[model samples]
Target: MKIGLYFGTFNPVHVGHLIIANHFAEYSDLDKIWMVITPHNPFKKKKTLLDNHHRYQLVLEAVEEYPAIEASTIEFNLPQPNYTSNTLAHLKEKYPQHEFCLIMGEDNLRTLHKWKNYEVILKHHDIYVYPRIADSEDQTQHELLNNERIHIIEAPVVEISSTAIRKAIKAGKNCRPLLPQSVWRYIDEMNFYK
Candidate 1:
């Protein structure tokens, strides 16, 4: 089995996340796309993040109808500041039968060098990078671009962002179009981001 890991904080699962995962499941060689919910990202601030369980549930609700995508809480059990390379190593060791690939946006490619064991990640796993609206041309022209392990996929570009959604919710605005119905209902019922 081939799995593509779409790792993120997913503070609140939105349409954009679903779109990319769907595209990978349909267009890429991946049999399934797992949205690995990272409890804590070393580079991101923890204060702005929602609870891991709540965020995980939101992802589950958002992808419930889509069999091709799954919500993984793999990072929840791991140590703080969950590193991609560490998670990748653990997954590879546990599921040796499955071929694991990393799915990320082109913007992250620019900062790949900042990640822990980034070189080892590039060498071992195949990466599928989707386009980001604000990604610079120079950022995409990294040395890894020539590596066969890295693939640039033309997935749909969604302008919607989790920060925008959170702001909308705090302002008491309707953001249903930017999120799945289930997720929107959950956020509304729980009064999240208020």
Candidate 2:
């Protein structure tokens, strides 16, 4: 089984995320996409982030209707200060039978060099990159990305961000259309942003 790891904080799961994940699952060669919900780092206390479980719950609700898309809480069990390289290594060890690939935006590819053990990530796993606004500026591709392993997937450019959604909710805006119906209800009932 080939799986694409779509990593995000998912502070509150929204429609844009579903769009991208669904796009990957439907368009790409990946058999399934795991919306890997990144856990809150204890050292980096982000007041905006809901509890890991709450965030995971939102992701669960958001992906419940999509068979090809599923929510994963893998990061919650990993050691703190986890990096992408660390997660990749752990996943390979745990699921040796399944081939893992990375699903990222082109913007992340531009900054990929800065990540810990980025070379290792490039060496071991294939990267499936989607278009991003920042990707338009870099006409010349980086030398490092000149490899067969990197797949530039022309997925939809999702402009909606979780931060924007949170701000809208905090401002008492009707962000229902921006999120999955179930997630909207959860956020509303819990009074998360308000």
Candidate 3:
């Protein structure tokens, strides 16, 4: 089976995230897309991250309706400051029957070299990159022309961002549309990340 590993902090899984995952499932050769919930990203600030379990539950709630999309907590059991290579290695050991590929945005592609064992990752697995706001056609050209394992997917361009959503919530603005109804309700009821 071809599985695309979609990793993210998922502070609160939003509609934009669901849309991207759906697009990848629809357009790619992937049979299923797993949303890998990471406790903390090495590149991102640790302070902004939500509790690992909470984030995992949010992803579960957000992707519950999509049969093709499933939420994963593989990172939760892994070491702190989760790295892609380590997670992939563990997953390979556990599920040798399925092939796992990386799913990310063009923005992340630009910083791929900074990731641990990036060369090994690029050589071993297929990478599907969706274009973000900052990463334009030029970035796509660079990625496609430079790597044979890379595929640039044309997903929807939404201005929504997790940082913006968090800010809106802090400013006493409505975050209903930015996130899934379940996620919003959970955040409101629990007063999370405030």
TM agreement with the true structure for every prediction: 0.97, 0.94, 0.93
**Tens digit of per-residue lDDT, candidate 3, span 1-194:** 99999999887789999999999899889999999988888878988888888888888889888999999999998999899999999999999999999999877887787789998998889999887888245554475546988988878876678888888888889879889898898888889857
Q: Which candidate has the highest TM-score of all?
A: 1
Candidate 1, overall lDDT?
Answer: 0.91
Clash count, one per candidate:
0, 0, 0
- Residue lDDT tens for model 2, 1-194: 99999998888888999999999999999999999988864334577789989999999999999999999999889987668899999999999999999999888887787789988998999999998887265433466467888999888888998888988988989989999999999998899988
Best candidate, lDDT-wise?
1
Worst 10 residues of 1 by lDDT: 134-143
Q: Write the per-residue lDDT of candidate 1 for residues 1-194, one digit (tens) a residue.
A: 99999999998889999999999999999999999999988888899899999999999999999999999998888888889999999999888999899999888887887889988998899999998886247644568788899999989987788988999999989889999999999999998999
TM-score of predicted model 2? 0.94
lDDT of each: 0.91, 0.88, 0.87
Order of models, best TM-score first: 1, 2, 3
Look at candidate 1 and tell me the lDDT of residue 111.
81
Where model 2 places Cα greater than 4 Å from the true spot, the runs are 41-45, 135-141
Candidate 1 has a TM-score of: 0.97
Q: For every candidate structure, what is the RMSD over all alpha carbons to the true structure, in angstroms?
A: 1.2, 2.0, 1.9
